[model samples]
Target: MLDRLAHSRGLPQVIRTDYGKEFCGRAMVVWAHVRGVQLRLIQPGKPSQNVYVESFNSRLRDEYLNEHWFPTLLNARTEIERWRREYNEDRPKKAIGGMTRAAYA
Candidate 1:
């Protein structure tokens, strides 16, 4: 996923993530090291430090995951991707003056 993001939008100098096992693991460490990307792990118990991701996760669970059941992993992925595109590209956000993120960008 990071690779795809880098390919599409270019690499970020720093990645801010929570102290999840997936982000803290050796592979993630090595991947960051190889790319010269700094990994900024938020302090434990401080979800406020990563409010955007936390909010997104909450919306994903409530609006999509909780409402749908998928018989296959591919179906789940497809639906989630659809939701993500709509959220990021189509949905208007009041924070951005009621413009979609894609339009704002």
Candidate 2:
């Protein structure tokens, strides 16, 4: 996921995530350190620390994942990309003064 983001939009200066295995792996730690990306890890069991991401993940799961049944990895990636584009470009977010995320950015 970070690789894809870096490829498309350049690497983020900081990465914020819970201390999940995927985020805490040695490979990811090394990758971030090498790229000078700071990792902000939330305390275990504290979803409030990363409320924005938690909220976004909730909406993505409810609106997209629950509605799709991808039969393959490629199909899943394609569908997820479509949903991501819509979420970032088409949908207006209340938190951003009713602007689409792309516009807000």
C-alpha RMSD values across all candidates: 1.4, 1.9
| lDDT scores of the candidates, listed in order | 0.95, 0.92
Predicted structure 2, TM vs. truth: 0.84
Q: Which pairs of residues clash in candidate 1, taking residues 3 or more apart in a chain or in different chains?
A: none
Per lDDT, the best of the predicted structures is 1
Deviation from native of the Cα of residue 26 in model 2, angstroms: 0.9
lDDT of 2: 0.92
Candidate 1: list runs displaced more than 4 Å: none
TM-score of each: 0.90, 0.84
What tens digits encode model 1's per-residue C-alpha lDDT throughout 1-105?
Answer: 888989999889999999999999999999999999999999999999999999999999999999999999999999999999999899999999999998999
Worst 10 residues of 1 by lDDT: 1-10
Compared to the true structure, candidate 1 yields what TM-score?
A: 0.90
What are the per-residue Cα lDDT tens digits for candidate 2 across 51-77? 989988999999999998999999999
Highest TM-score: give the candidate number: 1
